[model samples]
Target: MQVEMQDIHKAFGKNQVLTGVHFELLPGEIHALMGENGAGKSTLMNILTGLHQADRGTILINGKERSFSSPKEAEQNGMAFIHQELNVWPGMTVLENLFLGRELKNGFGFLKMKEMKALAKEQFERLDVDIPLEQEAGLCSVGQQQMIEIAKALMVNAEVIIMDEPTAALTDREIAKLFEVIDTLRKQGVSIVYISHRMEEIFTICDRITVMRDGQTVDTTKIADTTFDEVVKKMVGRELKDRFPARAASLGEVALEVRNFTRKGAFENISFSVRAGEIVGVSGLMGAGRTEIMRAIFGLDRMDSGELYRNGKKIKVHSPGEAVKHGIGLITEDRKDEGLILDFSIRHNIALPNVEGLSSKGFIDGKEEQQFVEDLIKRLTIKTESAETSAGNLSGGNQQKVVLAKWIGTNPDVLILDEPTRGVDVGAKREIYALMNELTDRGVAIVMVSSELPEVLGMSDRVIVIHEGKLSGELSREEATQEKIMTLATGGE
Candidate 1:
């Protein structure tokens, strides 16, 4: 399938999302769409896949102008879109989700369960997936859920598949497996539009690249014809010198310490300490209890046994409120669900944690609240029309920034960040790193949990590896490397 979008123009209300944007997809080539969070990469793809109709444009499929009414119609015509957020029904079985809405039924209106199971198994086998068909979709790990999405796309016999940040939740090993599957699909003449912020992955897998900026196509070039620096310059309209800023903060005494942290069936006997003005990065593969330990520390989940020390004094945290009272804040990984209430305004989300300070006689000071929100928005460089804009209306990077601002308002002595830059773009990531440096400069201890090795290495003063449910090894910044971290994360000596 060959797809060509010529002079696509789309707008929602007065906000123009795409203005004369253009994109192309070849039959069997893996073309990458590169852009910042709001650069219109997703909007262009959404138009192509029939989720949104273009106000003015021309869509040519195999050189014939065509338009699809809905995403289902697009899928039926050999196009599939695997969204970043998986679309699996938590209550349904794996097999059920695989055949959802397109189930094979008998003449009497009975489900063909056996046939569905066989077909799903065939797709799973092709992707080297080992999940049980009868298991609930919610029980699977994030990596497994990603595989399920891939299998579902293949089941539709899609000639063109659009994958949006497909490997965000996957482990290193799982990513390697996915790449292998992509290689096989390309050999079978399936075209893929791969969208991701990871530069290494794009350079490694993509044959051609198209860069979009400010809702317009900036440059389209072959992978071999471009460099990483050139791509970054095009995406941001300026040269981004260093991927990470320099850290020059001095270390202080231990700010937060966890001893004998134990959560049965989750993680066991995890011990770590982060000092003021220091960053301790926790590195591990998916489902390796990295998130579990952070949740326990933040009082989101119960730990069967553990002792927490703050400022050299033991303390008890039974809930998130208690953690905040003790000057500890947590920025959850799932920002959409745990971090922000999407329906609320950006001012509301930022002021939620600091209500007491902004209130007088149990009534919020509107002037103070507005000024506070505006200052943080400007400080963080969040692009928005107004502070009253809904947080849901912001892009992925700006949403993450709002979450960070919310935590920073708490004036925490110790901060725990889990995958802070998971869905963010390169430009926003650099800004976040600079903010981390500034926080540490103010003597705030930080613990960063991440799966991206480059990020862990770039920002962390020290790195700790977790495997299964226990601490494996720890390394100083001077000694840590990707190879050593992976070795320890996999329980090697």
Candidate 2:
């Protein structure tokens, strides 16, 4: 199997996402598609997968020009796209989801349940995954669900699979399992288009790499022939002088303090504090309750027992609205799912949090709302043609900006960001870091939950490590190394 995209150009209204980008994948080889967020990677993939039509481009499969009108046609042509967001019927069993669209039936039109289960088992064995056929997909762990998504693609007999950030939600052990599965697929003569931000994964599993930047193809080279620094330079079109912006200038008064926070099985005895003008990083492995603690503090989750104090004033956060009323805001993870309303335009999404203020006598003041959104668009440097554009039309990086913009509109004294830079490009990451620096300098305390160790150490004034939902240890910026954080994360004192 082979795919070649030539002179690809796509645009959404005035936004030119991909321009004259060329990409190719050889048979049985894992090819990496590398780019900064909104650098046209998703656009190119959408064009190939028939989710969107390329205004100008040619798609060739095995030296034959082909035209696909829809995603189903693309899959029928042996091209499958496994999205970063797992596409599974969480309410259904694993066997049911595998044969969802193309269920086998007998001559009498009876469902072939046993046959489907057997096929599901075969596919799972191929990936070396152990999942109960009767178990609901929603009950499975994120990693297991991802494995099911891959197996779903295989069930369609897809030879050319495009995996978009497949390992983003997986733990270390799950990542190893996914890599083993990818190796097996490559050996089985499946051509894979691997898209991920993690450079280490590229070097480990990818045979060839193609980089796209600013809607253009920078270069494609063998994995052995390039360095991580070189790849990043091409992706961002600049040498990254500093991965993280400098830490806060100095700590001010305590902005937010959580003491003896407990949430049943989610987290236990999670106590922490963030000073005004300080960035406190929360670091831990997956399922270490990093996100849970933040959710509880921000009123997204109910705490079994805890005391929350803002500026030495005890406050009750029973709901997100209450949190916002108290000058607290949260930029949640899964930006596309939780942070923004995709159906709404950028103007409306940003205005949602501030409706109370953007309204007049119980009715929303249209002019006031529009002006507020316009101000934020410019202030945040969000890349949208106009505030009227649907947020779904924007890129990952731009969408994240909207989430931040929406939260900042509330005028928060304490802000919590969970995996703030996840799934965004390097260029966008630098800007977000700079924004954090600016916010902290203005006396907004920030608590950042990050899986990236470098980000945890480089950006935070203090590092808080969590092990199995309990506070393991705390480290000053001077004392926080990868070794030290990992030791604490793995339950070391």
Candidate 3:
């Protein structure tokens, strides 16, 4: 199997996202695509997977020129794409989702359930993923859901597989398992197109690397022949000074405190404290209530019993409006669903929480709103044509910046970020981390909930682990480690 894309050019209206991009992949090789945010990586992949048509290009599969009218056409031609966003149906079970639109039928034309379950189970085993075929897909963790998506592609025996940021939300162990599976597939003559921002993973797993910058292919090289610094230079066209900024503030008195926080099945007795200018991180497995804890604190969900204190003063919050009024802002994990209104313009989204700040006598002051949004966009360094651009049209990294800008407009004293950098490219991830440090230096406390161990260990001033709806353990920044956190998270302590 071989895929050769020649001089691919794509444009949306006046935005020339992809320009003469050329790449090739061979059988039994894992090829990694590297680029910064809005570097035309997604556009090129979309063209290859048949999600969008290129304005001018040639796609040759196995030495034959071909046209893919739809995703089904590409799939029929042994091509599969697992998008960065999971597209599984929550209402359907694992087995049903695996065989949807192509179910096996008996001679009587009835649906064949037994055969589907058996096949689904076999596929799960082949990937070494533990999931119940009869269980609803929604009930599973995000990592398990991702595994199911990969298994679906494998069930069709795709010769070419494109995985976009597959390990963004996976733990170290889960990532190891996924890499093992990819290696196995490669040995079976599968050609994989891997897209990720994790430099180490690309060097470890990919056989060949292609660098794309500003919608053009910069260079292609073998993993063994390149270094991380070289790849970063090619991706950004410059040297990156420090991924994480220096923390300059000394910790102050406790700024936010939670006592006996309980939400029944979600999380319980989650007592923690964040001092002024301190960054506290909550690390746990998916479904272990990391995000739920953040939501509960931000008043998105009702708590059965809890006490919240801000600056040594007890406060009661029952709604997000109250949370904002009390100087609490939450950046949700699902940015597309809960953070931003896709249909709204960037100015409208940024000024949502702080609309009152831009109003005079019950009427919105357009000039004031525009000035505030412009300042925020500049402060956050959000890449956008203008503030009037729709939030949905921005890339994943830019959309995340909009979410941050929206919350920061509220001038919250404590900010809670749930999976803050998930699905973002490496350059964007570095920018976000630097922003967090800057916020902390300005005396704003931050609480981060992340599934990535390295992120939690690297950024947090203190670490807390939750297991089975309870606070498993808490460790200071100096004491927290991968092994220690994993042990506490898995209930070993």
Candidate 4:
């Protein structure tokens, strides 16, 4: 099967998101879509998957023109899209999520639970996914949830599979398993559209690549014919000198210390210290308690026992407000759900954390708020028309930036970033790395939680690994290789 989009054009009111975008995917081949933050990749995928209709263009499935009225229609036509965000119901079981709307039933009109469970188990075994069939989806790890999503697509017998940042939260071992599954799908003649920001994964799996810039198609070429630098340049239209900035040598006194941090069923005995000018990375599997530790530190979750010290002085943090007042900031993992006020404009979102700073005598200073937001947008290189633009309308990467800008406005001494670059593009990722370095250089301590090992190794001055709600190991940047991190993260240490 071959899927092609010809001259696709889509717009929302006066804003054009996709302009004359063209792409093609051949059977047994992985086609990658590369672009900057707001380059219309998601819009185009939405159009293809029938979530949005193209204003003008033609979609040909197996060289036959077709129009889909809804995502169900697209799915019926052998197309499936695995969104960047998982859509499975947390309360449902794996079998239930796999056959959600299309459940198999007997003539008695009852759900065939046994059959569904057996089928789901077989599918997982075939895909080498170790998700439990009867377990609640919410109890599963992020990587396991993703595998369930893929299994659901396979259950539908989709010929054209569109994966949007499928590996964003997956560990190296899980990613390798996913690649193996993709290979098997390709061998069975499935046409795949792989969207991702990680260049290494693209080069490893994709056969051809299409670069989109500002809603327009820049170029399409074979993966073997282009270099990573070339693809990145085409995506952002600029040369990025370095992905991670140089770390400063001078270190101030310990800014934050957590001793005997214990959270029942989450993490225990976690002891770590962050210096004023250091960036420490916590790397682990999806359920390895990395995010849980950060959440506890920021007072988002209750801790059974922990002693926290700031500059050698013990302090108690009981809430997010207290954490913020104590010069602590947290960038949550789920930006859409926890980080942003989507109804507000960029200026409003950026001013949210530091609203008091922008207010005077019970009235907000609009001019001061605008100036601060403008400066932040400039500093972060957020590609937006103006500060008045709605935060919801911004791209995923820009939205993440807005979250960062909002936190930075609070002027925190310690910043905690959880999956900071989860859905950002290559260019935006470079900017974020540079910003992290700049913040650390200015005497701010950073504690980063990420599933990406390369990012942890590249950006952190020191790395800590957590496994099954316990601190497993710690290493300096030089000692934190992919193998060592994996070993420690999986409790091999």
Give all candidates' CA lDDT scores. Answer: 0.92, 0.88, 0.89, 0.90
- Per-residue C-alpha lDDT of model 3 across residues 416-454, encoded as one tens digit per residue: 999899878778888899889888988899999988788
Which model scores highest in lDDT? 1
Instruction: Say which candidate scores most in TM-score.
Output: 1
TM-score of each: 0.97, 0.93, 0.95, 0.95
- Residue 311, candidate 1: how far off, in angstroms? 1.0
Model 1, position 479, has a per-residue lDDT of: 97
User: Candidate 4 — which residues are off by over 4 angstroms?
Assistant: none
Provide the lowest-lDDT 10-residue window in model 1.
Answer: 82-91
* Residue 492 displacement (Å), model 3: 3.5
lDDT of 2 by residue, 96-197 (tens): 888888999999999988888888888888777889989998777566788888889878878899999888777666688778878888999999999998
Residue-level error in angstroms, candidate 4, position 118: 2.1
From the highest TM-score down, the ranking of the candidates is 1, 3, 4, 2
Residue range 35-151, candidate 4, lDDT tens digits: 998999989988888899999999997899987889999999899999887887989987788998999899999999888888888888877888777789988867788889988
Q: Which digits, one per residue and each the tens of the lDDT, describe model 1 over residues 1-493?
A: 9999999999877778899988899999999998998888888888998999999999999999999999999999999999876788889999988999899999999999889989998888877788999999988877788889989998998999999999888888878888998988899999999999999999999999999988999999999999999999999999999998988769999999999999999899999999999999999999999998988899999999999999999999989999999999999987877899999999999999999999999999999999999999998999887898899888878899999999998889999999999878899899999999999999999999998999999999999999999999999999999999999999996
After TM-score superposition, what is the CA distance of residue 329 in candidate 2 from its true location, in Å?
0.8
Candidate 4 residue 130 C-alpha distance from true site, Å = 3.5
Candidate rank order under lDDT: 1, 4, 3, 2
**Of models 1 and 2, which has the larger lDDT?**
1
Please give the RMSD of candidate 1 to the true structure. Answer: 1.4
